[model samples]
Target chain A: MTDPLPTGATIGILGGGQLGRMLSVAAARLGLRTHIYEPGANPPAADVAHAVTTADYTDTDALRAFAQSVDLVTYEFENIPTAALDTVEAIVPIHPNRRALGTSQDRLTEKTFLQELGLTVAPFADVTDAAALEAAIAQIGTPAILKTRRFGYDGKGQARLTSPDDAASALDSLAGAPAVLEGFVSFTAEISVIAARNPQGDIACYDPGENVHRDGILHTTTVPANIPARLRTDAVLLAARILNALDYVGVMGVELFVTPQGLIVNEIAPRVHNSGHWTQNGCTVDQFEQHIRAIAGWPLGDGSRHTDITMENLIGDDMDRVPDLAKDPKCALHLYGKADTKPGRKMGHVNRVTG
Target chain B: MTDPLPTGATIGILGGGQLGRMLSVAAARLGLRTHIYEPGANPPAADVAHAVTTADYTDTDALRAFAQSVDLVTYEFENIPTAALDTVEAIVPIHPNRRALGTSQDRLTEKTFLQELGLTVAPFADVTDAAALEAAIAQIGTPAILKTRRFGYDGKGQARLTSPDDAASALDSLAGAPAVLEGFVSFTAEISVIAARNPQGDIACYDPGENVHRDGILHTTTVPANIPARLRTDAVLLAARILNALDYVGVMGVELFVTPQGLIVNEIAPRVHNSGHWTQNGCTVDQFEQHIRAIAGWPLGDGSRHTDITMENLIGDDMDRVPDLAKDPKCALHLYGKADTKPGRKMGHVNRVTG
Candidate 1:
């Protein structure tokens, strides 16, 4: 709305994880600073951000002070409490808007929204009770996943139903929360499109990267995904449609299941995604800077891939191999400075240029 | 010497300017935290460094406290006070070693050391007084430069001598400080090689970059310099020779004069050079990270150039052009985040990928 943020303006980030850490570094690259607000002490972003506020999201005083100190606000995660958004929105703008956040927070709403856009999504039915679950299973069939409609990530808060006989226990697993029954999507491969749009309606999409997950955690994302040209175009176009629909002002990650029929929307993240980390080495301007530029009202950069890169997440015990990884010229290590690396934790990532 | 610094260990930087700011960012990339020791308030490095100790370099207590907190110490500039190094060195190690620092601090000592290494150097004479200036002028010839023996950068603390008649005024301009009068060489171009070495004697050298200056301040440095392959190899070998001679344990910027006879050593910086900023975009491992890895005792990364680049400094009013520059996808901007820009001050730089 106002002029683009000046060189010294501060961008307020609402989370202090690796994404926030990378965002803080990117902001500093653009001659801007960042203030991180999080509930945890000694968050990963604390080492690099210009300022950090350690307070619960419900703390109105910290939220007000942080909003007042920054020229603009953006977040690293969706599912922020409505009250927290209310406390900050009254003070300053939050990019990717509440509509996108609200839609992505609940699985059912997200699927319905995508279907309405004339895009392919996994067949789904909302379940409110045991009877609804039975009817939905009869309609969508078995081998379906019953996911909590709100607050789920990394394989958490979900159960698998092999047959109708397992429906009651699956619903019980959700602990009385609203849920969605998504029929299994059989596909050849999975890929993600990282897209960005500015406040001015300008949009840019990075090359879709094929993804591989282990134990439901992202393991590797290789750019120039092994897909046909037609599918690549469809992936990018569908992603643009979602960005435009949300009127997004920052980067978003759109995960897709590549079926023979067409690409099906799996999920969407309203922030920079782990799968897009390859941009740090493969493009002149990476996703972090792109998000900062878009949210700061600056022109979007060219997202054309200049090199082939494979971004591999270094989880938990992978830290032990860092000395060997550091010796390789092609591997660019990006560690998050997490004090302790527990099992399944994303300690860092390595962007290895293949060519 | 003991072991490569762990993920959470801190690197204490001795200055808080743009070089230090960049080094801090690179240190964070390797999961290492940085503690910046700066005398000025609100230093450019303060916005990104993990911690900052603001006190004069002469403050022994502050220096001791800072050294005790960080695992290792490294500096951005060569002229750090001996006492400060003494205070820190008593507690922790300083990279590039004090000998390298001591040798590069004074122009006379630096030139003598290079000549002793069997390196080509400009004809020179030490001028202790006005009579010595006249004597040196008579020996080195008419066109020469009278420069302070210690603490000179960016053409500061020097006066040019066109003829014997101007000797008094040039000497008067330098006051009573010890000086050096050097005969100017008729060089075809200026090139710099950024080279690094670790404690184990492993070395890596970046390709030579040709430099251009305006008003005695560096303006641009282009990689794949317009020189024959033989000259390039000579420049790099000479740089490695210097690094090996000093038993260096970090990055060094070696400036050379390309002449008909051979390569001539102009001077050396015991830290990352401005010309090497091009590596940020053109190479997988940049000079900043190379220095951090060397000081941390990690293996040196490949310094191979992957793209052709020209780095241009944006001085003072150049900050006004950032908005337009940001629109160019090929140009990556690196700003210093100085609060105010005075004429001729280094506000930032842009690395344009030429090929």
Candidate 2:
């Protein structure tokens, strides 16, 4: 078993967005300091992190310096550049390993890996060219999503095909990027399981949370999801299977589709997920802390929910309701210290304890 | 009514200790940035704060520059020098006001103020010299405590006078510094109420927590203190009265000695107190966030306890048990990233949720 990190050790985080911001706060709570590395100036995580390095990931010197300054490294996002990883890995250990990141980074790889584990996932086919896309669409049938194999988020870098006739235009919209065509599953509800695994191979999974999205962006996540008890148990087991398969160390968010058939895996986030925000107010040990503990080589904490919570994202103009939300005693508001609020921007979120 | 400060505003914190560290984390959660000001180098709060100014409180130029950079000023401790307050107040508004700090800085002033407000405080007499100490001892009788009037904490600068024969030596033990002789109160238990008040004159109080101390330092605080419903209501009202009298804006900890007759005011802290740390796990909005909201001119959040929580201080050698504690799912550990752990030094705390 790996020895746990001592207090006062620094953890280098690869992103400086809200996830990194929350992770930095969690690291501080555990007596660990965070050094945030991002190319953007005045990133949100810099406000809470112990240190920040503003340099491009491609800058080998900056990456090496950042790695040497910390005991371990973790990334807030899965799409970290391979070159950046190569530079940091030589100096410090990165948790959730490069394999987990590489597998989750590409749609084709993730689907193949899940299938190898005997997990239920939507039928998907790799489409590297227009000819490949045409053949994949014919086999997948109508009403499918063609998503880029990498760097796709918040409904970006994706195109929907309503019928076979629209396949040409849909493939053209992808701009010749390698893509995957996934057959749409008729799911009744969307849910996600936030799971963690320490280096010792101990695993813990929080209860599944029902998710609601608007315009392909997550709007809210409610815990004690209105699913059957068996489904909940299955959701957790499937998440644990993925963690064990990857030999993962850190928190992972596994999004699933609840259908007439069993739960179908949608995607996996190798870091703290937006759907897991409810755990902040509902669980004794939140997902952020769980991730920190796991990456630090500590025993996994209990991810059991103690309270029922509904987490609502305050995107863009939704900040106008902050004053009203602040007045509500049950709402715990978490706002990212972003200077400007643009449309569809996730400015913050509120976790309301319903019970 | 004061207009609420906009998001992304910077809050200046005076002391960079664990309280300041927690306050900085809370401020960031509300989309606010914290600039910590401390005379000590490498203070604990610097790890999480957006900015840190390491300069002496006596440095007028540094204090002015620090205050000018933030929208408002608040403090983690009450013993700030009068000159430091004057310099900072000239640049930006300081929350909880100067009078509140002035009243709580000295034992004599705090006792007098509480008594003036018709609260029950132990009988106290100012002792400036040996002659004054002798007279005060005669009036207060034996089994009283003699403490320095200012700059005393965690039972420091104190002597117990069990009998008349010890009075001369007890007076000399203080080394001729100004002091106060206070007759001890016989009480059944000790409790404290964490209260907050916004600039708009609105107030909120967390349920009183039963406090246990070891070596004159807080050892543990359990919420839903074993008190009668009537006494709980009385505690909240008494705390509100003190906040209103001071015209306080920010959180305050009011310690009370529960006697057979009623609750006697032991003392008051103008900032977040150790006894209020239980709220971090038990309440929707913790004392740190409540203080930030009050200072930012926002509405007070609900202070109702949803779960029973007992917060235990991890002092000095107590950190040795962290490895074992990390295995317990119910124990939420919070550690200050201090390099050295000395006896009586608060290294961190754990909030264990019982319900």
Specify the highest-DockQ model's number.
Answer: 2
DockQ, structure candidate 2: 0.91
In candidate 2, position A353 carries an lDDT of 88
Native contact recovery (fnat) for each candidate is 0.75, 0.89
Error of 2 at A24 (Å): 0.5
Residues B24-64, candidate 2: write the lDDT tens digits: 99999999999999999988999999999999999999999
Quantify all predictions' global Cα lDDT against the true fold.
0.94, 0.94
lDDT of 2 by residue, A1-355 (tens): 6579888999999999999999999989999999999999999999999999999989999999999999999999988999999999999999989999999999999999999999999989999988888899879887999999999998999999988887888888998899999998999999999999999889999999999999999999998999999999999999999999999999999999999988999999999999999988998889999999999998778898889999999999999999999999989999999999999999999999888
lDDT of 1 at A332: 93
Residue B206 displacement in candidate 2 (angstroms): 0.5
